[model samples]
Target: MSKTTITANGQTKNLSLEPRRLLADVLREDFRLSGVHIGCAHGACGACTVHVDGVPRLSCLTFAVQCDGAEINTVESLGGDDAHHLLQRAFREEHGLQCGYCTPGFLMTMAPYVEEMAAQDRMPEDAEIRHAMSGNICRCTGYQSIVAAVRLAITQRRNGESTQ
Candidate 1:
């Protein structure tokens, strides 16, 4: 077992983990953060995406030991002040999620995208938005609502408004 430290959702823990243990397992089993879903176990499905050191990464494809002293953020960290994040509210209003299995991954993946675009004060074309989300696959929604949700968040942020 390799000694590893993972800071998840602002809580830091030191753990003894096997070299082969997937990060997804560590987050779910050790941290008890159920937001990281293991859909494909392969990297094809973005269901296990998490923010690793402030960047989106596939937790399922990563090793716990590899993350040694990395800071991680799961979907649980998405909100602050006891309210859903902008993207989350938009998703609910736009019906971006149905079964809710893939919602966490989508939120994790798009949070940066939406904020970056909003900060730039640039409105991405629908195709650009679709390309950014192409890494994730959701069998429930046809993606129209998903696209709409992202657009909504972008609009809200650009307008200096919160989805609250």
Candidate 2:
């Protein structure tokens, strides 16, 4: 077993886990962060996407030990039940999700892109949005709603609305 410290969803956690354990397993099984889903287990599907040190990464392809001292952000960090983040609200307003199995990963993957665009005070074009989100595979919603949701969030952000 290896001892590691990870800042997850704004909470610092000390963990003792097997070195070979997948980060997805550690997040879900050990920490009970069920939002990190394991799909394909191979990193091809971005269902297990999470932010490691503010960059999106496939948890399935990463080991628990590899994330030691990393700041991890899962879907849980996005918001809470009382108030949803702008991206989450946009997703719902735009019907960006269907079965919802892929929503968490999509949200994790899109958060940075949206934030970057917001920081630049610009909304991404449809093609740019598609390119940025190409890594994540969502069988449901056909990605149209997802793209629209992102666009909406960007618009909201530029209109002086708080996204966080």
Separate clash counts for every candidate: 0, 0
Q: Candidate 2: where is the Cα deviation over 4 Å? A: none
Each prediction's whole-model lDDT (CA): 0.92, 0.89
Clashes counted in candidate 1 amount to 0
Residue 35 in model 2: lDDT: 89
Q: Candidate 2 lDDT, tens digit per residue, 39-139?
A: 79997879999999999999999998998899988898887653398999999999999988888899999988988998999877899999998988889
In model 1, where do residues sit more than 4 Å from their true spots? 80-83, 162-164
Tens-digit per-residue lDDT, 34-103, candidate 1: 8889999999979999999999999999999999889999998987534388899999899999998988
Q: After superposition, how far is residue 77 of candidate 1 from its true place, in Å?
A: 0.4
Best by TM-score: 1
lDDT of 1: 0.92
Candidate 2 TM-score, C-alpha based: 0.95
